[model samples]
Target: MWLLIAVSVFVGFLIVLYLASPLITPKPLDLKGVHVLVTGGSSGIGKAIAVEVAQRGANICLLARNKAKLEEAQSEIEKVLVDKNQQKVIHISVDISKDYAAVVQAIQQAEEELGPVVLLVNCAGASVAGSFEDLSLNDFKRMIDINYIGTVHVTRAVIPSMKKNQHGRIVFISSQAGQIGLYGYTAYSGSKFALRGLAEALHMELKPYNVYVTLAFPPDTDTPGFAEEQKSKPEETRLISETAGLFQPSVVASSIIKDVVSGRFFSYAGLDGYMLAAVTCGMSPVTSIMEATQQVACMGIFRIISLFYLDHFDRICRKCKQERSDPSSEKKTS
Candidate 1:
């Protein structure tokens, strides 16, 4: 009993010590008159981001699959921008999942119509939630193709232009699933995790040329698509998503734009994010008092604790890498 009390007191003291620890974040980058591209600009988070950027006096090029939705979102963005400074927003309709050439062409056209593209926000991504047994192989392939490959396609398409300009910012809107594996997210989580490796590599490669890449690991937010996701979420998934605050689209838009403009490498929108990020970033040691106090203590009685979800994620990632290495041999004959 004394030992428990002593440990608790020690942990409390440690937290108090680090409570005022300095946070490492970036200085704000200017956005005035900059041309920005937002993939998946039709609805949900992408549309919100477009609005935020427009309000900041930047020219925006909106891209998404749906023509009507893209037009609708474009109107909203322009209206908001006009209220701020009487400026207009450009919109392009392109199917990101297919037609890489067309998407590139549309971007070029937008550059011609609007101005030079300097900021790229890869906000367009999606996932279908389901267990491994129930989900189809084709569905899994599509998830990777859109979530992972789509990021590559858009970023690669814009690199030459950005390199010539010598200044650019790329933000990929990754999810919590990508940060930590979750129940019934085999396909979604696998591709989402791929972004971390991709962004880390690109950050190192692009830093010399004045291009900065930011990967955003946002918790669940209330977008138009939330109702659809709720249909298949399991209890654990639902709980985590809810714990993330179910924030409105506007809040995410505002905060994410702030993060991108400020050149933040990583950001958690609120309190839970701060706690979750600290523990996960140092999972090897979990040296933070936050872990020693409430987290591990809660799971003490479980004699057989397992990082089952984490192991599954690692195995699938190895499988993903093996397939990427020899696409010709691992190529789907189906």
Candidate 2:
């Protein structure tokens, strides 16, 4: 009798939770005719996202430091527009990490041409992988400048309009490195992790005004930036990342756009990403009861799985260290 009663109560609670989910969920943002500004949109995942939004009928403003590349991306994105006559795409050349005034000016130009940006995608970022001591001070500074502060500059510039309009979506394209620290990512990981704090705080401040924030944790992707990153990656870092596999830019961009439009607080690309997000989703805003329940139910299991992953990673580190100390072992294996 007690077992049956317990099952009944659990089922009843789930039903209630499902019914209340609609009340907590934000209405999906429509992309048609909306203005979206994507930093680093001249190439890689940023360009992919611009194409995705353009296909949804949003006017796009691509921001990057290379004018030539920006123009190239603009031409490519223009080809994918749903409305060839009405939908427009523009590009701006500016270093988002260096000059706040330049970022502001660039934003003004975009808004003047396209209209107030209703969606801001903070995708501009840089990565440098090395041991803590091996990385130059400039490397650390550059990662922080481009990945964290650049995001800050662009997000800050767009806040006023988003608040005034009382409706907007902001996306921060943080990597899987942001969710968990790994070998040879001291500089890169620190910068990406900083974005989470900013996103969380901004989510609270903007929620009252109907503006939403989505922090995306994308796994290793096949992009020009990723190829560059591979050159600097330590052997252990490369091996560790390979376990999650590589994703295409289009797949990552699609997941990010879907989450942003749905007003999800945390966006992730794959099963591994979903597990990482759930494990790290402490005290973050809950978009729906279902999401909250999944986090609650899955957190413990995911944490256990993470421990196994950590052990495997530790083994890799130990093996690498052993090989370094005894060069003969590396040669013998080869």
Best by lDDT: 2
Worst 10 residues of 2 by lDDT: 16-25
Off by more than 4 A, model 2: 1-5, 8-23, 331-334
lDDT of 2 by residue, 1-334 (tens): 9999988987887788777633367899999999999999998899999999999999999999988999999999999999999998999999999999999999999999999999999998878899899999999999999999999999999999999999899999999999999999999999999999999999888888999999999899899999999998898998999999999999999999999999999999889999999999998887887787798789999999999999999999999999989979988988
Residue 89, candidate 2: alpha-carbon lDDT: 95
- State, as a TM-score between 0 and 1, how close model 2 is to the true structure: 0.96
RMSD of each: 10.6, 1.8
lDDT of 2 at 93: 92
Cα lDDT computed for each candidate against the true fold: 0.73, 0.92
* Best-fitting candidate, scored by TM-score: 2
Where does candidate 1 clash, by residue pair? none
The alpha-carbon deviation from the true structure for residue 109 of candidate 2, after best TM-score superposition, in angstroms, is 1.1
